[model samples]
Structures are given as C-alpha cells and as structure tokens.
Target: MSILGSYLRLSAADLARAVEQPGWAEEFRDEQTEREELRAPSERRLHETGPAWDELAVLLGRCDLPADLVHGDRPLPGAEDWGYGPPRLLMPEQVAAVERRLADLPFDVLAAGLDPAELGDDDPHALDHLAAEYAALRTFLARTARYRHGLLVRYA
Candidate 1:
C-alpha cells in the first residue's frame, strides 16, 4: 500500500517475468519483500531518534531548575541578550556535554536524580546548574553524536 511497497511489488513483478520462470519470479519477490520490510522500520527509527533526544534534553532541564529561584519570574541578570530568560539558558554544546556526562547513567537516574530545584536563583546557582548539566548531558550524547557522525561519514 505504501509507495515503497508499490515500488517493490512492481520491481519484483518485473524481475519475475523478465526471466520467464515462475519459481525465480517468486524468489525475487520474496527477497525484495524482506528487504523492503527491513529498510522502512530502520529509516523510521532513525528519523524518530532526533526529536526524542531534543525532548529528553528539555525534560532534563525542567526537572532541574535553579534551587534559589524556586518561586517566580525574576530576570536572571545578564541573560537578557542570551534569550535564556529569567532562568539561565543551556547552550547546544553544553547540552551535548551534559548528555555525555550522564550517558552511562540509567535513564531513571538522569530523569529523576538531579533536582534543579536545589539550584539558587543567584548567578552562582545558574552557573552551577549549567556546569552540572553540561557534565551530565555528555552521557546521553551518543545518539545525536552518531547522527552527526553519519553525516560526516557519508562524505568521507
């Protein structure tokens, strides 16, 4: 029913008739069917992994907000230009670093272990949280790093 399914079906049909042998045609069709089945899910999973990592990064940051500013919105001083808002912002590089630090950790530990609520609202708290997250994020950076590696690998 899918485009790929149709393409494989057509290809298999052509391969079968081309040789004028019913058995060979059937074999060709079967192999194409299996190959197509494997390709689709592999591509889909690769596509889904990117957004999953982004979502995971966000969840990690939210669960670990600064401890001091545990209450309301107060400008985090010099971060106005940084777009990080009242709470300190996490940079892309820093996020990757945190994933690496926390990669070996079990998912639950990374998810629930670090309490952002413990951080202070002051500059010190923001800086400390950034440092910790940067460290921890390194652990989980494998997936994204692989995606990046693949792109460069293709050219090489």
Candidate 2:
C-alpha cells in the first residue's frame, strides 16, 4: 500500500557480487536495514518521494535526464519485483553522466520550465518535495560520481 524510492551505494566489486545472488533485492533490503541500524537515516541515499515517484519521473523525463539516472536503465539479473518491479542498477559511469546533466540543468531552471498543473498538483509549494529530493539526488550523484561508485535503485 505504500511505495517509496530508495538507493544503495555499491562498489564495483560488491556490484559484481550482487548480480550473482538470485535474491539480490532481498539482500539489499537486509543491507538497508543494517545500514539504518548503524547510521542515522540519510536523505542522500533515500528518496522521500514516496508515492510521487511517477510525477518526479515525468518531470525528470521532461528535463531530458539520462534514462537510467532516476529509474535506472539496466535491470539487475536476479532482482525480484517488489511492486514497482525489480531494482535497477546504474553504473559509475552513468552516475557521472547524470551528475553532468544535473549540473547543466539548474534547479531554478527546472522549476521554471515545468508547470505544477502538468504534474497534477496545484499547491503553491507544489515542487517543494521535488526540489528537496532533487537536491538530495544531486548531492548523492555528485558523491557517487566523484568516488566512481555504482548505484542500485529501487521503488517499493
């Protein structure tokens, strides 16, 4: 009944190991649980988009983002469907590309370019969550790109 967007940071070695597991999605779940226990929940790795993932997807689509940056383009081999489908993985190179694209498209420009009504919202702060999430996403990508780390994306 509830859906949320989240991601897991992976090293290339871990990524290679992840693909070998038939239940990598569940494994990632456990990993997130462990991470939460170890560190305070972070907005950097967890998207607060909740059920508005579709809207954010549409808005990013309009912005001409990399097909895999938000929702991911490459499907993980053993990832199982958890409502929105299996988690997708973005390579380190893709992360860098997304970062570059985000740098080119400023948040102000993105907000100015899209209308709230088009995204099916009318609140005065219609883009507030989107802005916050986008900022988090930008920071996340920047960090990953700088470190050349891969990202595993999921919606559940």
Candidate 3:
C-alpha cells in the first residue's frame, strides 16, 4: 500500500499547548478517527511516499537539505495514532524550520536531478504529474507558513 501524508494546521495557542502537553495533537487525530476520515477539511493531503515523494526527497537531499526534513521514512518526533500509539507534540519552531527550507527548495534543480527510473515506466507522463503535484505541495507549505500554523503530518 502507498503511504499517504496530510498536513493539519495548528494555531499559535494550539502550538503552545502542544509544546506543554505532547498529547495535544491527539485530539485532532481522534476527531478525524471519529469522523471516519483520514483527513479533515482544514488539512491538506500533500503527497505520498512513492515516486513523487521519494524522487523529491532524493533530489532535495542532494541539494543539502536536512535529511530529517526531506527523507520520506524519517521518523516524526510527535507523530502518533494509526497503530503507532498515542500522539506526541511537535514544536512550532520545528515546523517553521521545515517550512523555511521548503520555501527555498529549487524546483528546477529537483526536476533536473530526478532519475527517469524513479517515475516508473508504465506512465509516460509520470514526471509531469509529479512536478505538478510537487508545485501544489510547495504552495501549500507556503500558505501554511504564512499563517504561522504548525503542520501535523499524518502518515498512513
């Protein structure tokens, strides 16, 4: 199964609370579970850990981006639920740092660095689709950062 990821926005107050109480983000996860949905209206399903995510991570890593921020399999400090156990807190500063790094990512460089094999062979336009999705994710990250919101990334 493909591993999907979504980003939820957290208010400043919420961030503060989360810092104080690591389980604070669990409420959002519980709400989502109660609704029988993996994502809520306020959250954005940004990318999956396959071709698009993996290729982007590889290219970004080559650019000297922090491995923790770009690597798809990197363990999230405060992530929880979905069989991983209770939710943990994520600091606002950590999210902000990631947002800043994402903002400076060179899309052109990523595209140039991507290996054709990463896109799969069946779909001739896989690269184009990946690029478009990556652009949308970049925009989403910018918007989230502009609002001073912390991202709660959920993986499943």
What is each predicted model's overall lDDT from 0 to 1? 0.32, 0.73, 0.54
1-156 per-residue lDDT for model 3 (tens digits): 655544455668775665566565566545644554555533542333333555555545655543244332233345445433333233456556666776776567667756657655457676776667677667766666667765555555
Which candidate wins on lDDT?
2
Cα miss at 143, model 2 (Å)?
1.2
Query: What's the ranking of the predictions by TM-score, best on top?
Result: 2, 3, 1
Best by TM-score: 2
Clashes of 2: 0
TM-score of 3: 0.63
Going through the candidates in the order shown, the clash numbers are: 25, 0, 0
Candidate 1 lDDT tens digits, 9-80 = 122234224235434433543475456546744231112121122233444455443221111123223322
The candidate with the higher lDDT, 1 or 3, is 3
Which residue pairs in model 2 clash with each other? none
**Predictions: Cα RMSD each:** 19.7, 2.5, 4.7
